[model samples]
Structures are given as C-alpha cells and as structure tokens.
Target: MIPPDNQIYIIIFSTIFLGGLMSTFVVAMVFIHRQRQAQSRQKMDQMQVEFEKTLRHVENEIHQETLTQIGRDLHDNIGQLLSLTKLNLNSSKPEKHLEARECVNEAIKEVRALSKTLNLDWVESLSLDEYIAQQLQRIQATGFCETSLQSDRSFAELKKEEKLVLIRVVQECLNNAIKHAQPDRIAIRISKNGRARHIEIEDNGQGFDTSKQSNGSGMYNLSKRMETIGGKFSLSSAVGKGTLVNLELPFSV
Candidate 1:
C-alpha cells in the first residue's frame, strides 16, 4: 500500500520462509523412512539368528538319536542274526548251512538300511509327509500297536527348518504314546487347507488326566515351541478313552 521497494522485500521474505518449511518437511520424511528401514533390517537379522539356532538344536538331537538307534540295531538286530548264523553253521545238517547263508544276507540288508539313516544329509531329500510316514511305519512294525496314516497332499512346500521342528514334535508324541499311554492303535492325518497345514495324531490308549500331569513341564514346553514357530499346538485326553494331539501351522504365501 505504501512503497514499492518495501513490497519487493516482503515478497522475498515470504518465499524464503516457504522454501525453508518445504526443506524441513523433506528432511523429516527422510529421517522417518530411514528409521523404519533400520527397524525392519534388525527384525530380519534376529529372525535369521533364531532360525540358525533352532537348526543346530535339531541337528544335535538327531545326531544323538542316530547314535542310540545304531546301538540298538547292532545289539538287537545284527547281533541276533549273527548269533543265529553261528548256531546254524554248527549244526550237522546241510540245510542248516543254507539257513546260515540266508541269515547273513538279511543282516547285510539291515546294515545297509541303518547306514542310510545315519546320514543327516539324507533328510534334506525327504518330504515332511514321507518322514512322518516312515516313523509311523516303524511304530507299527513294533507289533505293540496298530498305526495308520492319511495324507491328502505332499508337504514338500514346507521349509527344511519347519520340517525339522515338526520331526522333533512327532518323535515326542510317539515316545509318550509308547512309554505311557500303551495304546492299542494310533492314527496320523496330515492335510493343508488354504494357508494352514494340519497334523492330527490320535491314540486309543489309557489316557491320563491332563489336569494333573505336570511332572516336568513337558506339555507346556511343546506349546511354547509351537508358538515360537507361529504355529498352534493342542492336546486332548481323558482318563481311559484316548489322547489326541492337533497341530496347525500357517504357511507363508
């Protein structure tokens, strides 16, 4: 309204203030973006570390189990076969010699099977369903209980780490059934629906009361383990009817 020179100075000041505000806004946005990126990277690194730790734990467990199995096989299986072979050879009958040869052949076959199982790397080539089925078959072969498996799909889509975790879980369930439940029959079912993978293991055994079986935090540990993997674990049992374990795993898309 007054001097023209003053109006030009006013316009210059307004432009400077607007430019400073724009610059500050850009700097703030960049700082926030960088902060979020750092947080994401930290989270990813932590997950990787956890995964590696789990893998090592599983490997150690498997190694210990393998050693036990080898000892059992040597004493119960191969040793028995060799003893029978020696007895047959000592007999006067020619037919006994032939039986000795057959015994030796069976012993060799058993050793070969054990050798394959001794190799931890062999697990890498197996699917989760196949691994579970093998364990069920072994349990059934014991003649102490009848075992069955039902699977609608293959579980090759799961990561190796996931499969290892599941293997330990299944082993625990089987041991509990045999050691405590004394089940007459056991059933396992595996399936996938949408993004969920399901495993159901049921046994018709003399079940104990779930309310009072807190000797060593066994059940609690299993539940915590599943939660760590973003999975769900449940146990159902009665005094005499049976026990059922249901596990659900969510898969990444």
Candidate 2:
C-alpha cells in the first residue's frame, strides 16, 4: 500500500475521475436547458393554435348576430311594408295602385341587399378599414349621430384573426358611444404607433364615471375580447366630459 509508483497512479486516476464527473454535470445542465426551451416553444405553438380557434368561434358569433338583426328587420320593418303594399294593391283607386307598386319595389330591393349579407364568406373578403367604415355608416344612417373614419392602411394589413377580434372590439366601442354616450359626433382614428396599431374612438356624448358599469353597456365584454387578443383597451370619461376609447394591438399575433 505504500509503494511510490502506485501512489502516483492513484493520483492520476482521481484527477481523471473528477474531470469525467465535471463533464457529466455540464452535459446535464445543457440537456436541461434544451428541454426547457423545447417546452416553451411547444407552449407558444399551442397558444397560437388556441388563439386562432377562438377567433373562428368569435366570427361565428358575429355571423349569428348579423342573422338575428336581418331576421328582425324582415319580420318587423319589411313585413309591415309588404303588408301595406298588399292592402294598397287591393284598393279601388288607381293612385293607390301606383303607390303600391313603388312600395313593393322598395321591399324587393331591401330583400336583395340583405340576401348578400346572408353569406358568411362575405366578411372574410372585406378589409378591416372597409368593415369599420361600413359600421360607422350604418350608425350615421340612423340619424342619431355623425361618424367619421380615418385610417392608414398603408402601414400594414392585419392578419385575419387580428382583424376579427379587433372588429368586434371596435363595434362594441361604437355601440357604447351611441347608446350610453349619446354623442352627436363620433370620430374614429386608426394608425400605427411604432410596431403597435392604435385606434382611438372619441365621442362628444354624455360621459359617466368609469367606476360604474354605465348601465351595462357591454364594456366588460369589450375588455375581455381585447384581453383575449393580447391587446390593450382603455377608456376615459367624466360626468361632463365625453368618452375616449383607446385600443392598441401588436402588428402580429
């Protein structure tokens, strides 16, 4: 056990063993790091898939809402008009006959226009800015308010999912402005802020305290939709001041 030659061999063997242990530990650390990275990438991919699926679900909901609106218009407004036309056609006077024909023609035109909206694919074909403008036009047509749109489409066209969620958010904002705010004028501005897209909808309507729900104007739903999309939504208003809605979304999902 006290041989000098053997002692030297023992020392050499210990050094080699220590070196191997260090190498194994280093390799283990690297493996752990790589495993964590893989898991993170998988999580992100899964989230993206889920986000897209949610967008499709929301799109279907919007389509259904549109269908309900069309149904009500047909049953209430168009149905009444058609009934009047029928009654006028049975009248003895020739003047009433001419008026009946005009009424029937008007109802036919409205039905044809509504038929176009019955198709779901029509929404996907429209650009984001175009869709927003159409919504604002509908509000203006109601004569409750005057609305304007200003958008910079040259910045970057949004992806389909991004546009879908954001459109609903914008719609909610517009409806809130009309119902709760009751503003005579509404201005919507859309532009880019660095990599984020900015949308501001300001109205001169009567303002209410944000702490209150404001008669359940669907503010919660708007905020939730924005959160789902990883976007920011903020509102500012007072008792006398008008309401301003600010929404910011990243360029890509």
lDDT of 1 by residue, 49-80 (tens): 87677668877887888789799889999999
Q: What C-alpha root-mean-square deviation, in Å, does candidate 2 show against the real structure?
A: 3.3
Off by over 4 Å in 2: 1-7, 154-156, 211-224, 227-230, 250-253
Tens-place lDDT per residue, model 2, 102-159, is: 9989899889878988876655788878888898888898788999999887324766
- Model 1: what TM-score? 0.80
Output the lDDT of residue 156, model 1. Answer: 62
Which 10 consecutive residues of model 2 have the lowest summed lDDT?
154-163
Highest lDDT: give the candidate number. 1
Model 1, clash count?
0
Runs in model 1 lying further than 4 Å from the true structure: 1-40, 154-156, 213-217, 227-229
lDDT of all predictions: 0.86, 0.82
